[model samples]
Target: MKLTTSALTPDRWSGEVLALGVFAGDDVPSGLSWPRGADAPLRDAVARLLAHGSFSGARDELVAGPGLPGRCERLVLFGLGRAQQVTPHTARRAGAAVARTLTSGPNRRVAVALPSWRVPGPDGGGPGGPGLDLVEHLAEGLSLAVHCGRWNVLPDRFRADYGSDLPQEPESVELLGAADTGRMLSRAEAFTHAVVLARELVAAPANLITPQRLAEEAVGLATPGSRLSVEVWDEAECRKQRLTGFCAAAAGGADPARLIRLHYRPAAPVGPPVAVIGLGLTYDDRGVLRSGGAVQGAKKFMAGAGAVLGAATALAAVGGRSEVQLLIPAVAKAAGPGALRVGDLVTTASGATVELNHEDAHGRLMLADALHLAARLGAHRTVGVSALGLPVAAALGPKAAGLWSTDDGLAADLTAAGYQAGELLWRLPLVDEYDDELLAPFANLRAAGPPSGDGATAAAFLRRFAPPGAWAHLEITEPAWSPRIDGYYNAGATGYGTGTLARWLCTR
Candidate 1:
């Protein structure tokens, strides 16, 4: 959706739908000041609803009606709970409610009047201060909620199949606020646009987004005079590069594999480049003779690749000084026919031997090769991306992803980035003892060792390939996607880490 900042009030804004926040009280929210008739539509809607005894404005309470009919079309009332308890997260949810409500029908345009999220505090300024952050994140929530990431659209029968509840996204969004941050809001929309791209890539059918397709898509990122540079190492080059672990994981797939590398170069060279390696498993079919490998959901295995690519895309759009390279092991983890066996031991370009235990844990092997390649590319700082629900996602549930890092500073930075982007991440340990979990009798390590510390052992395995400096392994998972659209993220691929990745890399 096209997003823009405007000073227009809900009363004057002529749009298909208008959304306004209502605090849980009889009095109007004191945050936003307006002249006479500025908030007439909102006030009138609330007054009418109050008369009907259905507008108590409790937290999360939503009231929608044909307020002002033709001129405004519809007005949605969102409860903001208590004013003192309002926060960024609350604002985001409120925005999402607006998006979901607006997109459920035939509305093609929306205007939102968000109350100032600033809470007066004793320190003279609000905790989050007065700026465009509230509006920015609110806009992001809306953009994500109303976005359509589907590659296949049965246009005429869309409603018949998916129902009108699922949205194709409104054509435009108007965020009515006094803050004159048109440029900043535009950048926010650009960032959201990239995130939506990641969601689209992840949500697409696996057959359509094969390793070859992902490679071509990376190449497409390079435009004339753009700072982004793309390179693809085909299966042969991967063999030449001695990426044994990647080769093993990619074995049974008849489709060719690719190690897609993208570099965002700056005019002036800085310190060592930061590298992000994503497990681009386009599809997964496993042979779990070792532990009864029951692999399912092969389609969205490429979620991590979509995230890092989305981050790179957003960073490229909003120019950054630091050099960043994204390494994607664009290959399918095919099952049956020559799939890596349970007892198979593999070596990587880094010469680290890893015993393949669980076929589902094959992702770590690919990440190892990519990390080694990143070191060769002069990246001392590296990040390996994993989709949500790798190992024991139940530990963190749907709210936060797991973060494992060799450096405290990088871990702190990444955690902070996740929080700043409203994507929660809890740091997992990289304990010295966990390193022993992967000590294999046959090889230098095992992709997975004891179940004692499953997540940390995976990170320890990745630590083997990390060059010096700071190395972090991000284990992320998205919320469940539901056929019944629940908020912006239903029961499907949540381009979960794209925003956090962009926030972390762009700021650095």
Candidate 2:
């Protein structure tokens, strides 16, 4: 969908649908600023419609009615909750609600008039009124919702199974009161493309997206003349670099492992380069082969790698002063002849030996080498995103990802970034007590701990490879791939970490 901003007032806008957002207890048409005599008739019509309909301006509430005689074909009023509590997230949800309500209809053009929010400045006090940030987020939600279901069907699916009717995506979306200074639209487009790319990569079937394919995708991100540059490390390079853990985890698959490194060097440097490592198990069937459990959604095991690539794409598109490096140890953890057996001891590049007690705990093995490489490469800080453990999902539920960080400053920054990006992150303690669970009989560490305290133990295991007080880990499971439609996300890959990483990199 094409998204643009306009200075046109809601009443003067000629479109198939006009969406007006009002905060709770301020449902009157005059709550929104309008020209002197422009919206009188539209206000009267809305007032009559409000009187007859039970359209309280509660959160997510929406009501529609016929438009004025010769103006828009439909007038949509959506609730924005409370004025004081309005935020970028609120704007995003409101945008999604409007898009979902109109996209399934015959409307081809739509206008959205949401209230402006007075966001607090960095120091917590300043005249930071509604501007590019709000407009960008609003556009992100609308575009995401419109394209959420576009890749639900596979290429080889039968035409009958794909269905003939699809939602009618709008041709154009106009932010009724905002201005297009060019940056707003570009930034929003960048974010939308990033999230959509991440979602598509994660949603693809395992047969279509292998480890080699993932490396190719990373290479594709670094187009000619782009700020990003990519390098792929094959098995020989991995062996030369002593990436034993990465190679061992990838040994089971017929396709060789690829260590994808995407570097983004800005025009001017800000701070030291920060490295983001993502676990890239393209297909995980360890549960099915080891414990006889179903592996229906194992393809989503690569969500973290998808997020990493997506963030790289966005950061490259929206140039920033911060130099960033994205690392993905792409592999597939399928059961085969060369798969790591129980009691197998693997020495990582960090010189730490790990006992493979649990064959399914291979993601951490791949990440161990990547984290060590990041630290060895002089990264100021390192952050790893992965679908690590079930205990984390059980603790944090589906709405949030579990966070464990060695540094308080890094943790706070990441938490703030996640909140701003509409991704919830719950910080968990890096309890040193759980370190004992990772001790191996012969090796320096064990792959998995006992069933209890597994989440903390998993984080503790990874901390060994990274530098002290310079690393953070996000253990994401269900949030990466939603089982049902939630907010603007459809029932598939949610592209959880892309926005968080992008926001963090840009702000840093």
Provide TM-scores for the models. Answer: 0.88, 0.92
Model 1 Cα lDDT, one tens digit per residue, 281-382: 787654223224423265456778988888877878776678988899977766658778888878788887878786576687788888888988888788
lDDT of 2: 0.78
Task: State the weakest 10-residue window (summed lDDT) of model 1.
Answer: 151-160
Strongest candidate by TM-score = 2
Candidate 1 deviant stretches above 4 angstroms? 24-42, 53-59, 81-88, 103-108, 117-132, 149-160, 287-296, 478-484
Tens-place lDDT digits, model 2, residues 174-262 = 88778754687798788778888888888777777888888988888888767899999998899999998888888877567799999
Q: Rate the local accuracy (lDDT) of all candidates.
A: 0.71, 0.78
In candidate 2, position 241 carries an lDDT of: 90
Clashes of each: 10, 0
